[model samples]
Target: MAATDDFSKDNILGEGWTGTVYKGVLPDGSILAVKQLWRSSQSGKGLQAKMETLGRVKYW
Candidate 1:
């Protein structure tokens, strides 16, 4: 859990049809917006595929 603590109600920044966004701070003090996707919204394989696609995009 990268958040100031575990993803608690106090850390929730917003919610949407896709998932919930939480405010997080890394160990080095870098701020981050963390999104927790709903399990029912996408299958594990589908998520893996999307992550792979994003990895490829990063190389461009």
Candidate 2:
């Protein structure tokens, strides 16, 4: 779907402390939003900690 190129200043929908969202349009004119999470390379949160946090996420 070429999502990388689809996200641009013109497609920005919104943003927050965790990440930014971009609106994407399809060939058929359908619209969708992409949320790219914000993570720091130097957050000091180790792999174990990250895994633990993810494990706690309740996805229904």
Candidate 3:
């Protein structure tokens, strides 16, 4: 299987050391960006830790 044409370079939104970000439209016309993360970078502060930190943030 392959990704849709919507995931091509023409729809590129931005990029980072982790992955290339792409802008995509669903069949329902909703817009969204897809991120492809690098497997080697999923350590250190993981998702649960990040979420816990975010949960502690006090908004003004």
Return the TM-score for each candidate structure: 0.60, 0.53, 0.59
lDDT of 3 by residue, 1-60 (tens): 023364687877788776776776777876655665556465667755754764676634
Sorted by lDDT (best first), the order is 1, 2, 3
Question: For this target, which candidate reaches the highest lDDT against the unseen true structure?
Answer: 1
Backbone Cα, N, C clashes tallied per candidate: 0, 0, 0
Task: Tell me the tens digit of each residue's lDDT in model 1 across 2-55.
Answer: 464788889998987667879898888777767787756677897788668645
| Model 2 accuracy (lDDT, Cα) | 0.65
Native-to-model Cα distance after best TM-score fit, residue 56 in candidate 3, in Å: 14
- Candidate 2 stretches with Cα past 4 Å from truth are 1-4, 40-60
Q: Using alpha carbons, what is the TM-score of model 1?
A: 0.60
Q: Whose TM-score is greatest here? A: 1
Model 2: clashing residue pairs? none
Local distance difference test values of all predictions, in order: 0.74, 0.65, 0.63
Model 2 lDDT at residue 10: 74
Instruction: Candidate 3: list runs displaced more than 4 Å.
Output: 1-6, 47-60
Residue 6 deviation, candidate 2, in Å? 3.6
Q: What is candidate 2's CA lDDT for residue 29?
A: 66
